[model samples]
Target: MSTDPHANQFGELAWFKSSYSGTSGGDCVEVAATPAAVHVRDSKRPQAASLTISAEQWSAFAAYARQA
Candidate 1:
């Protein structure tokens, strides 16, 4: 088992699927916030790889997304 506390750590995470995510379950993205970082994953593949981005980076990404 991995020693990393954040590994396989989706449980209890307040995952919020993007507003753009439709009921058809296509192109769905989920985000979770942590004290030290922001976690992003695909809703269709919850157990798959996730992207761990720093809070600052996440904020920048969010700002960019808003403008896009």
Candidate 2:
């Protein structure tokens, strides 16, 4: 969880929110994808620190989530 924007070395990535997100904006996250990594952040606090993981890791996690 690097707070430094430069840590990821990806500049100004476009983030997309989940379609399941509600108007009330409860627990939800927005994700930005790049060739090398996937960035995840709280939709409620877009300016806050984000979690960065490899694209492969994200794909695996997404597959596991689909199973659940």
Candidate 3:
């Protein structure tokens, strides 16, 4: 939740938004994934703080989300 916005460490990751997000600029979520970790951020605030989690944790969360 605390990566320097100007750092290039995460700049190389290809981030993408959800297809379910509206085109009219409402709330949106974006994601980027590496072999070891997954990154999540608000689409409306790309420069703001983002969240990083392990791939295994993402898998578990995705599974729970699917159930909900």
Candidate 4:
């Protein structure tokens, strides 16, 4: 956990790509979840900024995406 929320809080987090993402992929996203927040970033740009959301928000998003 970091003192600054805007910072790359857990740069060492173990990021995982979506199962739907192919190795020959064009675009892909990766996610790293923590008890406090879920971090999302583009797999193509591993050094880029990550979008962080609350655990609750991540849960809601996952549910909605599954329905879609």
Candidate 5:
């Protein structure tokens, strides 16, 4: 999805790691949410590019994950 002109960039966003993730940080992703989008990136490489999806899409995926 295309980002709006006013959307928050990666550095400006506040990211969160999953509560279940290990403190030693093996394989996990960090997530950040904005009003219009959800951002996901590897916890090991925060500076790398992230996947951004619409909030609606994220909610749908989250529901599916819960079911899985």
Candidate 6:
């Protein structure tokens, strides 16, 4: 992550909607990639706050989701 707190530092990340997102356009999460971390936010509110997680942590979370 860069010293800047703004996600804009990521420079136009290719955001992707989660596969589990409902087709009805309900609650959905989106994610974008940075060099060292993944940035996540709600698709309904792109201007809202986002959470940044380390690549390893994101991988662990994905693994846990698959297990569940």
> Which candidate has the top score in lDDT?
2
Model 2: per-residue Cα lDDT over 1-68, one tens digit each: 66656245565778888777868879999899989999999888888889989999999999999999
Which residue segments of model 5 deviate by more than 4 Å? Answer: 1-11
TM-score of each: 0.75, 0.81, 0.82, 0.79, 0.83, 0.77
State model 6's lDDT. 0.81
lDDT of 4 by residue, 1-68 (tens): 65443345445677899777878967888898887998898888877788989999999999999999
lDDT of each: 0.78, 0.84, 0.82, 0.81, 0.83, 0.81
What's the C-alpha lDDT at position 18 in model 5?
A: 84
Off by over 4 Å in 3: 1-11
The 10-residue segment of model 6 with minimum total lDDT is: 1-10
Which order, best to worst by TM-score? 5, 3, 2, 4, 6, 1
Candidate 1 per-residue lDDT, tens place, 19-54, comes to 667699788888889877898888888877778899
Residue 37 alpha-carbon offset, candidate 6, angstroms: 0.3
User: Model 6, which residues run further than 4 Å from truth?
Assistant: 1-10
lDDT by residue (tens digit), candidate 3, 1-68: 43656234545667898777869999888898988888899988988888989999999999999999
C-alpha RMSD by candidate, in order: 3.6, 3.7, 3.8, 3.8, 5.1, 3.9
Model 4: residues with Cα > 4 Å off, grouped in runs: 1-11
Q: Model 1 clash pairs?
A: none
In model 6, state the lDDT of residue 25: 90
- TM-score of candidate 2 against the unseen true structure: 0.81
| Model 5 per-residue lDDT tens digits across residues 1-68 | 33532237444777899889969869999898998899898889887888999999999999999999
Better of 3 and 5 by TM-score: 5
